[model samples]
Target: MKYDSLARDIIRHVGGKENVIDVVHCVTRLRFRLKDEGKADTERLKAMDGVVTVIQSGGQYQVVIGNQVAEVYDAVLEAGGFGNAVSQEEKPEQKGGLMSRLIDIVSGLFTPVLGVLAATGMIKGLTGMLAALGILSTASGTYQLLYIIGDSMFYFLPMYLGFTAAKKFKLNEFVGMTIGACLVYPSLTAIMAGEPLFKVMEGTILQSPVHLKFLGLPVLLMRYSSSVIPVIIAVYFAARLQNRIKKILPDVVKGFLTPCITLLIIVPATFLVIGPVATWMSQIVGAVTMAIYGLSPMAAGFLLGGTWQLLVMFGLHWGMAPVGLNNLVTYGYDAVTVLKSATPIVTACVVLAVALRTKDKKMKGICWPACISSLFGVSEPSIYGVTLPLKRPFIITLLCSALGGVIMGAFQTKAFMAGGMGIFSIPSYINPETGIDGSLYGYLLAIVISGGLGFILTWFFGLSPEKKEDSASSSASDIVINSPLRGRVIPLDQVEDEAFSCGVMGMGAAVIPSEGRVHAPVDGVVTALFPTLHAIGITSDEGVEILIHIGMDTVKLNGDGFKAHAAQGDRVRKGQLLVEFDMEKIKQAGYSLTTPVIISNTPAYQAVTVLAQTGDGAGTENGAKISCEDGLLCISTC
Candidate 1:
């Protein structure tokens, strides 16, 4: 419950628990699929504390929560009444085009294991570096143990993919895992390596040695270890197959019978058809990618590296992960993806430059942490929080990273294994057989020049004096909170309750209501409406949050004298009647009709000025009558 408040706020702002169709988390974000994206308050979420930023892309509402995203994700599940298992029935109707859905599906499948994947990759890379450096002998038992720990995930990647893919496709997870286990079964792998009975598809890319016979059909076995696409396709097929089997079988026998029938059909079908096709497709993709990279390595590097962060911003970065893994499996080492190894370092350098030059304390604070995180290969914070908000610096990062990519590509740098990110990934360049090679040196040199130049260029050219770009961009207009009640305007401090009077809730003017109607203060959605109808919260379309409390300690009356005209999540225009109360009835009930209208999220704004009072005088003093049409408060974002 450490993040309980943040969790509740997130759920509320994301159109409540009912709006969420499904939710998943990655390294640093909580990705939600909502039934209606329109109900979400994007600006309100962006202004929230503990959230790094909010992104809507690839058919997802992604809330970036820095490194604590996992804990926050757990809290969100608990708070939103969600079970750990994802249900296919819960998924919203698909929106967006093919690309968007692909990105969503791919990210979801990979996100669950990304953290541990990176960790294991790092461990393997480090051990490889140690072995190459002669710090540990490859024959050493300690080395063997460490390698096994690090390598097991990659070796049995098909099974992991099966488990995750089954969840994504809504199949029984264990059934998919069983299919994967069958693909990588030790005996099957050994058979694939043995002498073939005959060769089939003799003269084409599809040509393969027939390894074994499956009920008289020639089985074309594929090396499933460390592979990507085959298991995913197989699992999808198994999921569909299982669903079909369940429909035919009766409930009494279906529990065990469904899987038994599914496996019998899918396992052989996979080895005979799905495996060969997917493996060929993966090989074709790898071949095409390598050929493209081989044509002009630097150009490929420049394009991919420059746009890498942009892809990360939209969560499309996962698309390239499969390709990289395919290359690692098809070819022993990957030369293409290794070109982007310097991108994080480049981002780190750029943010460091921003931290050094920015006059704003907040930007400086954000930059320092972002810079540190980027150095460790988590650049989402730097990209979304620090640089992307300041357009010039973000552009500088891309250009620098592109140049770094060009340099690395020119040297033909390659990654022998799926390594760690940022600095820890350096060891992935070390040749397993040779000590330090030109590739590793070339990578080191590329990062140095690229990162150093990034700092220089960003410091000198990325910012302007006063760092006014952000302020200028946000200067479209000030948000005006109109008076929500016909009453005598009074200073908040003069109110009876200390919570509102002392500005403990937020800063805003109060009113002594002459009438009982409460109107919408701005064009916005009603975010919160208390059951007692004595209080309401509205976040304006432009992101100012306003709270109107009917009276001090009014909860005792419950819904006695209060009536709601608008419910929570209702979209209302300025001056629209939201709530009505009987003033005489409240007065007779002995409750003070002192209403405090406040900006609930005051800290996100630069200033909250009480506009001039009306009727009696134009100054912001007490005892001035104000109408619902009058401008009561002006909020400035920058």
Candidate 2:
């Protein structure tokens, strides 16, 4: 509820509740499946308070809100009047290609459980660490209790996945869970462990031991506990079956009869056919992944590690998560998780180097917090705000990460369990039965070398100081955004609206207009002209984005006493008329005429300096009156 106002602002900027089809949250992001992404004001949302960044990827609009994403997500849902369940009618038509859809599906399925999954994984790793250090015996009750806390999630993973997948496939959740429970029932598991009555195709990989017969049909029994693919496949089929069966059945009995028939048919078929087929498929997936790693560990590591962050940026990393989990369940260890582990540390080091080296105070402030977040295994801030924007530092980070992956690969490092990221993940590398081992040492060495090189290389080669001539010369890249209105200047923070004053929407000065005419601040195309004629956005030829909002809450007037001089997408020169509004009318309507001129893409520049000027071009410190076309803010590219 504390974020209710922020949430309302976010929803309005994201094109309101009508634009949203579905929304969910992971550890640090609020991902929305929107009906039309173009309707969302991405730049405005990016600059909004409480948002770290905005990304449109994997067919979703993602708003990164750091660790507090869940609370914000709840706020968004409540503020938008979107209850817990999204109606089927609201589901948007699927967009994008196959890869995009796959990424969307995978993210939806796994995101719901990621927080608790990581928590339990950390507990498991801690128990392993204690046992490895001889601080606790595995036989002790304390260790046993801790192990169960950690291990139960994985042991009954199918059930948890069943519940989530059912939501995704629009099935009755209880039925999906019932299917999962049947797969791992004690009776079925007991029968699987009993002596085989017959063996089929004994010489081939398809060979199976028949533990029982159902209507003269041999049941190829296999352990379903901890398996990934079987339950999901079963649930998908169950959903399809129940839907069809319900349509023909009488309405009164449909609810009860549909579920009973669905369970009666799907559960047995899952045991006899779907379970075996899906288990084999999972094994093939794991085997193929391991075979690639086995062929040339170093090469595989270099490729995967280098592209990991890129995949993460686009949200394609979700597609890789199940593969690692499958490998852990099938082979008891995964190489994919090992190869990617060094990336966050590398990102942290790169951001740290940038923080120390940058002369820009604003850049330094952004980098320090981003570097710390990267250390905790969250790197979106570092990637989007610092390294990626700077260009060279991000490239250096990738090269360093690849080198680290090479080292890890050559040592055959393996992750025994899913755990926390960055330094917290070190315990997962500890060999359970052998205590301290080569894998742990390999992991430590990889991170150290990668992180070390990330800092050293970035500080020296990645970032260089601006040339003296470049700093002094009037280059084309340097833009001067003039005052859009003849007004008395004020600090942006003094503006009444928090969205404008908090500096989250990017830095610029506010003006209490002495005149009603608004002019183009730079030579650019009109990117946006709000229907109410109270706001305008221009993208300068030099790539500087400026937003001129006429007055506080003037939008509520709905175009009263406002006129647009130029339409959206019209090319205009600096000082050209854009809009004319009646200041007296806005004030009469109880609105503040403290208009904000913001550099919407402030992160792309080195610094945005506010200028205080007088009639004779003399500089003043406070409340200087300015004319339209006079220099307001000087943007430094260097």
Candidate 3:
């Protein structure tokens, strides 16, 4: 919740606010556009509080903050500035780069739509399931009411596009919406319906043709409901037109004239050229997709199912949405059938693996909700919190997905509707004329085979080291405490904050007195000292890695006032110093000194514990000790 301070520290740590170009947010990450990627302090940011992880992907420096990303994004904006203007200018010019620009434009257009699209998709999926299970009947009032819940959004999709386009193009949103509304107006829809209003003979109207024109140019009437491209183009042009007009027009006249002129030009042009062109292009895309589906259903299935996860990883899956929607609109079904079957199977596999591999009660508790959410077609929890962290499970799940996709493709399975990937998507697979007996069997079989095989494989091989280690009876005498700091002992859990409340970060007695100094807690070798110097890892003679982390967000200082006493691979003794810092200077620089003494090699430990309070003084017999039982100085205490 208090990520403002952390964000400020991160910006300053990564070469200061001037180095940042722009900051934006996705569902769970703060994506930054930096002037120079090389100057980023990745390790330092990772060590900060409230940061779940950090990733550099798709030319973006992504700081993952989980559910609280909006808060972090606000904090980042306050610390840095708005817009990616700096980064944009710093970007190198490319030759004949239309393709790259197109890709960027398309990605930007769809980014904000992804969340709503996914939600609507899930809702549609659920409606199908309810109808299928007899809980709701197609002819019933209840079913009709619920159907509207999911269908209205898609039916008025042009409006959604207009809003998103306005945001993307930095235009007036209401104006965009008005333009979209005009295209979908009841009268326009009625005119576009059935057949041509009239056949022109020598450019003369017969039976009063419903032709719309601007300045003598005939406008081509095309349906805009559920359409994607035309409204976006209209809004983009409208924004530019409005801006240009506003610059020269008097303020009193500008307000009314801008909208009047924008709509007049945009609406006619949209119908005359933009609408027709976009429709033709969409048709081509749809045809191409159908052709691919017809060529090899299994191949298409395998590719879609196997690569869907990868697309999701890069946030590029929204590019395929038009295809799915086009299929639904054109043929009332989708031939790319593997996703619904493969996604659930892959999710089930990961959930099963995590359930069996982890022994940590807290972790297990978290995984359960993630697994349940996945069953409903939400994979974020599983992807970020479970599978990705475990490594092997994620790969295995993907492999299984590919296998399942191939089977579905071989069957030439098709979904007769557009919906989310889950059990609820079964209705989309339904052949209504033949009832539930059509493609339903094949889909069910695919799910069982892929999920069952994946689950069994992971159960046997996915066990984590932390689960197998003994924790209830390990002894501190067998373990060695490698000093993370060289300063004098200050006692246990001293500094401040909830991070040190239950020793969640680590376990050990706290230290103070010296000027932010770090020393070897035991005779061991330094295995890793992060580039940011926020934390260090030392492997003791007993083969346990002791991690010493300085104050929270201290990494944001970017090694400014701290100096490392040793380098990687250095051998040191219990009292050998590792790093020295100006504690007073660091505190004044705005960093919390609630240090954590963690066991980086948690797998090697049976248990670790914190003993005594801050004033209890170190080196005393009353201080903490690692043991098997739950006591103030025992292992079970953790």
Which candidate comes out best when scored by TM-score?
1
- Candidate 3: where are CA atoms >4 Å away? 1-128, 138-141, 144-295, 309-335, 338-340, 355-398, 414-421, 424-441, 456-464, 471-490, 493-508, 511-638
- All candidates in order of lDDT, best leading: 1, 2, 3
TM-score of 3: 0.45
Model 3 Cα lDDT, one tens digit per residue, 394-480: 677777787777777666666876654576566667886666753666677777788877787677765423312234545434443
**lDDT per residue (tens digit) for residues 146-217 in model 1:** 889877876776788789888778788798888778877989878867899998878865566888898899
Could you give candidate 2's per-residue lDDT for residues 1-638 as a string of tens digits?
Answer: 88899899989988989998988764336778899998999999988878988867657787877535657887987899775544211232233466445434544465566556555655665676667667988899999999899778756777876887787787887888888788778798778768989987677544657888888887776666656557877898988998899789999998699989999998888878864564454444334445678788887678767877765543234345567888899988887757878998999999999888765565676777667657766565566556765667888989989999899998889889886667768788888988788889889999999999999999887665422223453565576788999988888888876656766667899889999999988776676676667778787756678888888767557679898888654557878988889989988888899998888778888998887777645443456889886888989898
Q: Where is model 3 poorest over a 10-residue stretch in terms of lDDT?
A: 86-95
- Estimated TM-score for each candidate: 0.47, 0.45, 0.45
* Candidate 2 clashes between residue pairs 3 or more apart in a chain or in different chains: none
- Model 2: how far is 329 from its true place, Å? 19
What TM-score should be assigned to candidate 2? 0.45
Higher-ranked by lDDT: 2 or 3: 2
Overlapping backbone residue pairs in candidate 1 total 0
lDDT of 1: 0.75
